[model samples]
Target: MTQKVDTAVVLAAGKGKRLDVFETPKPLLKIGGKSLIVHTLDNLKKAGIKNVFIVIRKGDFVQKRELIDYPLNIEFIEQTSGRRGMLDSMLSLEGKIDKPFYVTVSDLILSHNPYKMFVDCGVAGSADTGALVCFDSRQNKESGANTKVLARDGVIREISSRLPSYNALDLGIYYFSPKAHKSICALAKKDKTISSVPQFFVVYSQKEKIRSVEYSGDAWFDVNIPKTFIRAELYLGEENSAESGESKKERTSLKNLPKTVLLHNKKETVTDITVKRNILERLDEYEVIPSESYNSPHHIIVDESIDSFLGKPILDKLLSLGYKVYKHTVKAGENAKSINSYVKLSEEILNKGIDKKSTIISIGGGSVKDMGGFLASTLYRGIGFISIPTTILSQADAAIALKQGVNGGDGKNLIGSWYAPLKIIVDPATILKLDERWVSDGLAECIKQGFAYDKKLYNLLKGYKGDMKDLDFLESVLKLAIEDKVRTIEEDLHEDKIALVNQYGHEFGHAVEHLSGYAYGHGESVAIGMRVSAELSYILGICDRGVVDAHIELLEKYNLPHQVPKVISPEDILNSLKYNKKYYSGEPRFVLVDKIGSVWRDKTYYTVNCRDEFIKQAVEASYN
Candidate 1:
């Protein structure tokens, strides 16, 4: 049996100089009539903590009266000699704490106990290592980007010092067991002075396994800066009906929270994307199987390569439920996304006797989904289709666009149509099983989406450390990317309406893919294409040189290649772009970004028609 921690240490010594609004200790600042420390203590008590030691600076003894009426067994410790960072604060109780204990910063504002969830995950009981509460850095960029964590399979590989980019930020909440405490102390003893918490963890990870518990709930907020402080005040005030003097304008501020989570009610839309850590747990909601089998039977089109990863579990569930499921495994890869493949797949589905009552389930990457979606649209003049995308690129980019098609002889997606799936189920669990190259392929598309629409989205990718196994982080990224793409598509479902800003890199990306004869994967070409697009925008005097540098910065950050390969000639790329599907008359329209979040829109069309000479120069510049 594993040990359950009952004691905790709260590091509350820091002065609130950065916030500029609070003259008192940051934790003593009142929120909804309760100080931040009071809120933290309440949360610990709720989580069944037995005792808590609050560490403060020497002169901050005046702050003790603030927590005098606290409910838990509270002990106060003053940092007397050589007190430096959080590790020093926690170490002040070295021998006094016998069991594993919870450690959190004092300035965190929470509507719920994240520590409770951390303990429930069995991090304290595990024999391998300890646990740290991590959150998406993309949400609150100020404090979130302070410390970077590199993790794999929920285990921290390294901490402290940014490495190209990182996605999870340590929220300063951790469960350190006796074993970890011993290790951290041993490392600290060798140092001349005290080490910070993240520094200690970085050294400790070299010899031990450290688990990272990613926070998913919406209630967690760190009030370290003025921008976050204002947001926190409004969030807390909105939930507290007990507070009086709330104005109508304050009520309107509630609407500004992420639109998808508006007042906890999802926005109305044509398509729905369900992002979950454990996808199979929510299978029943989609009517995945006919309530009664006498109706139309369902047919499954799965990528054979993923049969072991995602297929077996889903198929097992449907079989256990006693519903008849017919499966057709297609070869996985871009080569499988041909018109011939679509015809053969359609014939197979028809032979299986699938009808309108039966939902067409696609389980694969973009290629597999495209083949299956096209078949679903044409068969019986169209049928219900549900997409279970296995690749990150598919989930983050292709899944929400509702464009289904097969490759024509002239170009990529030349034979596709606008046919949306009834529902999209994104399971990060399956993505964890992909090869790193395949995972990197998805990050490229995710990076493209970031450069085109949302700066936060782009920053998220810039910081993503390729943790295929970090399900919570992946789910958040998928949802963010999906929402961004969905909102863009909804605005211009058909390119005829406006230039699809989401195609920021696809124009040249497709041309490169065609010119290379498919030697480069879709994402690989797109990465290089975006570099060219940014350069072209800069050459045409539409964007600044920094815009070009930002593209290369992100491309190199994700280990994506930006310089066009020597194998593909610039002349070939130009020829291919002319025949590209998105071409009008003879000139191809380009989607260019002037900055991180804004795209340049031409007066006549959503895409600016660039001169051929500028396109050639951009293509030439992309080469090494």
Candidate 2:
């Protein structure tokens, strides 16, 4: 008897778009004398698997009706994630399975039993990888429809159907732990483009690990691939020219760097702003200065709001130092994030002879960072970008973030880049002139972040007695908030669903900001949205009345609005949600917190869908 796993999952939820000629679902297609999924079941039986969960779509009754009498303990899971293919089928098993189990696609037909060795060779006690699978390929011809891989020392470096160069073929079989499932689920939530297993592994290999088991046997082939279909239908595995690919040069993952570069003085302190830091000193320290830039004028992208206090003086100082400088003052508010503003600024900068080798220093707060960083990442393919955050919210948020973009007509920042600046300069003197509202605006973001990940940060904010004028207090908040944010991002370098926790009030908040006709401040809308989220959480019975009260208490402390403006209708906010950038499958997903210190995360879903009735009630309740 083969080794047995008590549980196994069979994925059969694909549309089989290429096999449209056959009226039956691909899993029901007969190979030899049996259906495709039955062949998988027979193999599992031989491997001693007792329980099987087959994932199929909502109306896939034929699969259930056909397998009703199977001896194995079979339960069909209906995939309700809008028919997104194999990826969604896996996600449909969320909270349904908790242990490491065997997995295979229904169309993966095998004549000879490889399951004994597969279950026996399970990966354990390895911190580098939590999942194990096999690889083999007949690399004689251009059979590229199947998943390809490039692995070294039994570790998968790259695996994708779109891989231009690869050495092995994915066996379409896996031993997946709960950790592996979470990685796949998170990538699906954040990025919808990953439909196939290989595409996900390509991204998964970026920060996590995957171990490749050698499978040189001639027993298996996928039915979806046309070339393999003929072999599976006619000869089965009798004539599979299975060959282990030639070993390529061993290359390790040593080139990968941290997505964000947080440079600060190494010494511990209550406030680092008192510690000396400068823009020029950082430029030399990071060596972003190009050889051709000695005579070339470096660009300074400044917002009109700070052009007098900070922008013009910085430009004058550069001129006094005999350094070439080019100052471009963009519109200061939300309008600056408009596509018109971005196009106009780009045209002006290009006309001013900004080249690939030039360094562009971005100054001012949030909108300025959005515009300047987007331009820098796209200009001349890419150029040197230095960030100077001038507000407390942005200081804690940090310009070292990977996402950058300007606004679109339909939504806020619909067009954006998953790119970051080369360096960041933080000088406290820039924030000294900030108005009280600007200070409040900055504090709102830090407060949101604190509630999501760090209770210490929330405690810090709750106990504050002084006004926003306290520089040391501001520095302490920034340090704590930035540290927590960076730690969360480091675990998920792709910033997939894991980082979405920090966006506690963004769903309803973004919609409110858009529908408010630009009259409501970004911070004001977010404050109101936080209240809405808390209300929604209370309605859902996820949190008690105390959590909601504490949420409102903090917002009111900084002169922030906790009640929605009567001018904005709840219906408008509901309709505007689909236009928001984070809309999941056209449904309004809210990130709700059960309490002060943690966000309500359902497995990989940091933001979850809510009924229109509940969302409307929350928004209406917050209205004055």
**Worst ten in a row by lDDT for model 2:** 268-277
- Largest lDDT belongs to which candidate? 1
**Candidate 2 Cα lDDT to native:** 0.72
lDDT of 2 by residue, 269-364 (tens): 121221223443333343334455656657888989888877887777666656677999987778867899889888888888866677777888
lDDT of 1 by residue, 435-553 (tens): 77777778888788788778897777677676544777777777888888877777776754332766778889998888888887888889999999998877655578998998999
Q: Candidate 1 has which clashing residue pairs, if any?
A: 166-463, 499-606
Residue 181's lDDT within candidate 1 is 80
In order, what is each prediction's RMSD in angstroms?
22.2, 18.2
Candidate 2 positional error at 210, Å: 44
Instruction: Looking at model 1, report the run of 10 residues with the lowest lDDT sum.
Output: 260-269
TM-score, candidate number 1: 0.55
What overall lDDT goes with each candidate model? 0.75, 0.72
